[model samples]
Target chain A: MNTRFILVLLFLFLFMPCPSQAEMGMGISGRTEALVIEQFPYVYEGRFSIHNTSDTACLYVLAVASPYEDVTEWVAVSPAAVEIASNGYADIKYTIAAPGGYTGDYDIRIIANGYALSGEGTTGDRPVSYLQTSGSLRISVNVTHNAGDASLGTTRPHEADAPAAEDPQPVDVGSQAYLDVPTDVSVGTAVRLRGGIIGHEAPASLCIVLSSPMGESYALPTDYTYTFREEGVWTARLTLPDAPLVERQIRVRPVRAAGMAGGAYAVAGGLLLLGFLALHRERKKGQKRREKSEARHQTTLSSISLKSKTLEGREMPKGL
Target chain B: MYQKTRITALIAILALLTIPFVWADSESVSATAGINPYAPSFEYVEITDTELSISSHLDVDREYYLHVHSIDKNGITDIASLVCTLFFAGDGSLSAGATDTRSCYTLTYTYANGTANWTSAPAGHLVEGDCSATPDGYRSRFIFAFSLGKIAIPSGDTNTWKVSVTIMDRSGQTTTYADLPFDVNDYIEWSGVPSTLELSSTCMDPESPWTLPQSQPVQAVVTSNVPVSVLFCGADLMYGADAIACETFTLETVATPAGGTVNTAYAIPGAIPTESVTLVDTAYGTACMLDPTLAGYCNNSAGIASFVIDAATGATVPYVPAGTYSAVWTFTLERGAGVTP
Candidate 1:
């Protein structure tokens, strides 16, 4: 019976939580958990969540022993990972850069250093006590290439509407695009300028500007301009002048014009009114001339008849 | 029955005699070398700087050659060498695809007076680096990394150093040594930091000293406007206690800067301060020096050292060792923005 009693006392001593001896009741509290992460082929980044579940406020930190000398103790926990304040609970997260193609494993221990108080009746008026605990978790990760929706070139399920062309967005250039011009054009050779807005289908007219290498500028007419109606493709052709063909710079701008049809209507209307007035005057003159001619013919006929009466009927029928 | 008893008694005695010998020899660090009794030949040695620290590795092969281009704060590799060991003093030099035991040789880096021979000597390859502040801003210091080829020291006797090292030049005659200190079979790692760098003599033990798991602080007045935090700091391994262990230290910014950043450099304090050197090959009677101080000199002269030879002969027979050597080195500052208060 004595041996059994001794055994019970030993068990209690080993398992019982230790209490803080300081008057301020400041001591360690909460539990610590370990994260065992496997390495990846490329740079691998991940975050570890540190949950605080203590009655009193506490601070938690992570300590790592690296083979590298550059790594040191008390590496400041990233502020973005966790929130810590006086007398408050928070979670700490760490975005750690795993060693490239790491074939080995390491231990990361979380230290929970804080203080709290026990219930008034729990420990013979010693209400304040420090609590500390720890747990560990292992992650065996296999490095892999995950071709998700974005990687497969499929639009995200909840993507917003694409922005307009005027927005200052960076666009990827095609491999075939180049800015090469002839050093010496046999004057009058038509050179082409190609520029385009990506992902848009519209007839785009680019204004081409030619400048000499010596900073001299001259304006070229756009009378022979052509537009590209295909999306993401703009081309403009221009005949080079005899001078400044060698080492010249060319620039193109897109032009958008509004209210261009109103002037054409006014000119067509005025031409139609003029044609109507000329036709009306010609009709009136023709009518008056026809009446006069008819009257004269009738009078001649009458005279001929009277004469015929005198000369008897001999030439009268013939003359009539 | 009498014959059987006698055989059993004889067997028991033999077993008793062998037991003590086996136990005595079991606890030795050295092995009765397996197939080839001699140490393996080093084909080459490569040095590189990783995100963690600077390290060196040895390649076990037949032939090796390395060129050291430059050395600065980044890492040092300005002097390279192509070492060849004439086994038995030309008894069994390396030939095309020969796999005979007689052709094999060994080399090592011997230690004495608390420092290794290659490390303490003045004329040997000495690559240094430093980071300093300039008017422009923080910039990385330059360092040279190198790879060199197969040359082993003949390992017939204990007195003969088992190392044959040769410093190959672009034009000058090659510097060759047949016997050297330190075992060629074992590799050495050299690295350091500028402030308060210590070479621990205990590092002669390969396994114990190679990895520095402890941290040492630099004793310098805070010069920067801000409470300067040293991000990446390194130094060349000092002789004596610290032999062959490269140490790197990094610190984060806990407080703000309070002063201007200071330029920190790691150099052999007692080295001669001449800026240029000229190497003369005796047979050709031609003198070549990449001297920046002289007219029509090369611009980026870092490791240009002069060695006056009696004569320059295209043949190895006419080769004589010139005593003096020099190299071009540059110092620059790093992390100015972090240093600003």
Candidate 2:
């Protein structure tokens, strides 16, 4: 019975969990679970809390690791070592800074390992002996450059429609009569002039006149005789020279001659029209003479008949 | 045999009991760096009306603001110093007594609460400092003003430099961060050339009766550190040589205030007397000269000279083709004129 009891006790001792293993089950928690760091030259800070779930007091060490070895220089974890009472918690801080001109993303891991303090110690300091529980925290830092200008992201509002072109409203320039002269005209070319008597009936003696650049005036015909001798922008006026009290003014631009002359096309068209009319007149005259001859023939035929009848009557019967 | 078995079992049990104690005694506590999920980010460097403060890259003749942070878990009480050094390519070291090798910095310790100010050193060096902490953590801030005017590079050339930062805590723990590379470049530059030159229009009709001499302005702009001259060569629509001379066009140079020195030189052979002048310069300067006789140098003062191409009746204008022509203006800069790389 004694041997059996001893064996049972030994089995129980071998199967029992280790003190460090029990402490290792404790969890480490952080106020900031994940981190995203900006590119170098920018500072990033993070905070974490380690919870000692087990009844045993624990000592912990903080270690940081990254695939980017250069990050170690820019990053730091404070309170590299810590002591916490059983079922108590402690806070850890880490700061990372990106070097100037550094940009991109980085993945870093922070690990907290808890060790069960064997002997009783105060909260201030304790001798760390064995590994108990370990927990890991993950963070990401993305570094970027700030935009130089704020106006770049803003959009301009849509614009309203533009105003329409101004109408050509006529203005009274203290004139009794005025000519509607074209704004553009060719030098040495005839241009039509249209006029209306303002505030009165048509002036009987009104005649259109054109003045050259040299101040030389020439009277124009009713049909088409207004001409300019020089190439320039000139003004035309409807003059009532006999009635000097009427005041009127008109202006037009007579530009230099461009391309082919307009008169050539006009002359060619007129000649074609005259030829067509003359041909039609000749055909009508010939038809009228033919009709007159036919009528005379008919008249002659009647006279002959009448003569024959008279002879017959005079000559008497079959003997004549 | 029974006694030996019992003894073996007892030793095994003893070893098992001691195993837990040994493991517990050896394990040590450790803390890991944590991550912050919500971090601020920007896409470009910040610029202010008065200055350019931050940038992702370095440019020659531009200012940049560099900020660094130092944090300690134990709560930073005092900082011994902070220093930054720059190393160029091809040996990774700055020359002895080179003032541009290192730039000092100023430190500002901001507690987690966000209230902060800075203490600056007369030079670029950073000295001992202290920091305060809030509910967040303890932090030391370092700021530096950096520029790239210390080095000379060729046009269209780029060079890389490495920067390193070293910091020390009051406890004598020295930490260094290094291997940050920056690129510097020089851009190619040229000035005083007009975007386009327009010539006079000619009548399409060969039988046009109205004939008076028609002329158009021809000008050349010169901006150079070295003596330079310009030659205007004309060709027909098919690039036929001697088209301007065959057309009997003349080039007359007109001196203006913008044109520091003016002369006329004729490069075309078998051309009639058209006023042309040429000049020589003993020093570097810009010279505008019109020479229909020969291609020669003008005075050495930077300026622009105006010229007129006289078009006679039935004669083609210089640099103007019958329909469309190409004008080739050759600009030559003298060698060894003190142009810096």
Candidate 3:
């Protein structure tokens, strides 16, 4: 009888409604696990079809997880998180471009994390007290860096290492212009807009210009000098005759006021403390002098006050 | 007198025969058209807006939806066909059939309208929209319902879906229009893995003695499908005095939410917030980046929230007893407008 009842319980559990039986909240439709890119300054295009096998709508977020920081800079994907209807799917488009100088093969794994929250908005009651983030889908990207190819494209300015374009439009551009100027500086101060052009050079003259809405303007020379006569948002451009190779926005701030608004109160508090200390010291000094005089008079004329009067070289003092 | 009456009867019969032809070719948003059908029966102007919705599906369905509004329904009688083309757009625009359009969207088609059933679009094709115009509105302001499902999607295709509804008038003049830029994807991955939350003394810089160590905030990337807010389940996870009070925990924005309607009422502003004490003790947990874009999976620049737990309690992180702390979290789905799994 006991055995029969146990078997019946097992049967019921097996057929019970199990939401977990479906495909996990999120899944990748593509069969392949690895992605291969042919060249350096390499630009790779691929797709990730996220399938929501569960009965509920799910959200998935993609993030790059690799030891190499360069891999993160190489990839660009659109629409951060996707919410697909039950059994429905959506595609994730990605563009991967490696820098110019990198060579050899490196492994990169991009993770797609799925989320479904139990709590409603800011006002609703939640089943749990906090949000738990888990469940991930990964794509192992294997990038091979051979020689340079203008066709492959790059994620960053290749001038530091490689070039991306062919001519005016070249892939893996090896030429780069860098500006080493601070973003905020005061007026009347000479701010040297220090920068350089690296990698391949254009056939035209390299120059830098500071432009602002105000009348202040400067087409910099080899010294890279710029004297800010006014305060405003200034645009710094590194131009190579035809186009501005690199541009940096700087805030030229006017000199600050003499004293700080908030700090002034603290300064006043310190001054009051010093005045109290000085007054206290003076009182103590006066008390000591009177005490000394009192002790001396106590041995002679006890009735005499500390204040004494001397006339014709004769000191006179009594009860009066 | 008998001859005159007979002539009038003959003229009446002739007039009736020509009137039916003129009425059949009447041109108006509500009228039947085209005794002479033009090159295109329908005129297309510009797209107003689109949203991904479930109301578009009739019998079976698609993911993205285009609610097409025609300024004038004139000359258009019936929806001829829906051509869902999938292609590798090397160029940016998803034109009707540019030189670079790939041919794999629909393998078998009779190339005509209605009584037609697709064998089902192949796997990677992005769209197969079903849109039809009804005479419910006034002559010039008819709303044509356009529905798109993901029967097809090509890889690395961004904004490559061009869902044009083929509209025809009574005279059989046809026109097709609607370019839908949806960020749908099959291949996807995150820009980075969940960052390691390191709040111990090791993270502290030895060179700077006074500086405290701050752990990055734990975050949830909110979706646009609904008004989303993060619920820190074990509020006790912070207040429990196992070792250190979780008050030093902070919310950080790793990426900004793309095109999300800021719920000015639902969230606290600022890209990064420094309110750990108020969050730990308060009823509402700390909100990461609350950009609910009514949501996509892989755009790194799109917007991601990083929830950090820093050991830096103000200028100095309180001393914590050395030990390993672990937590098991279950990420569930918040389905519907604001419904949860």
- Scored by DockQ, the top model is 3
Task: At residue A23, give the lDDT of candidate 2.
Answer: 23
Which candidate wins on lDDT?
2
Q: Is the docking of candidate 3 incorrect, acceptable, medium or high quality?
A: incorrect
Tens-place lDDT per residue, model 1, A1-320, is: 45754664565455444433211111111112223333231232333333333333223323332322211121233432122332332434434444332223333322222211221111221111111121111223332223222132222222332223321111211100111222222223344332221122212332234444344443444222322222221222222232111112222222221121223334444454445445656766777788778888888888998888878856546556
After superposing candidate 3, which stretches have Cα over 4 Å from the reference?
Answer: A1-24, A27-62, A66-97, A104-107, A119-320, B1-39, B42-62, B66-166, B172-341
lDDT of 2 at A179: 39
C-alpha lDDT of candidate 3 relative to the true structure: 0.39
User: Which segments of candidate 1 are over 4 A away from where they belong?
Assistant: A1-157, A161-170, A173-184, A188-209, A217-320, B1-341
The sequence of per-residue lDDT tens digits that candidate 2 reaches over residues A1-320 is 45754664565455443322232223433322234333234577766556555555555556565544454456677776666776565667888765542344555656554444432111111111111133445565544433111212122222331112221111211122333444445666665554434333445666666666667776653224465457653545444553221112323334523322334444444554455456656766766777778788878887888888887668678764
lDDT of 2 by residue, B14-108 (tens): 99999877767535635589963321111122211114333333433334554556665544344555555544432334321233211222233
lDDT per prediction? Answer: 0.25, 0.40, 0.39
- What is the two-chain DockQ of model 3? 0.05
The TM-score of candidate 1 is 0.15
Interface RMSD of 3: 16.3
How does the DockQ of candidate 2 come out?
0.00
lDDT of 1 by residue, B1-341 (tens): 99999999999899899987777785764547565222112233232332323232222121222222222221112222233232222222322121112222322222234332222121112221211111112121222221121112222112122234554322333445444222211101101112112212223333331322333222111111111112221122221122221112222122222222212221111121111111111110011122112244221111111111111111111111211111111111111221000
Docking class of 1: incorrect
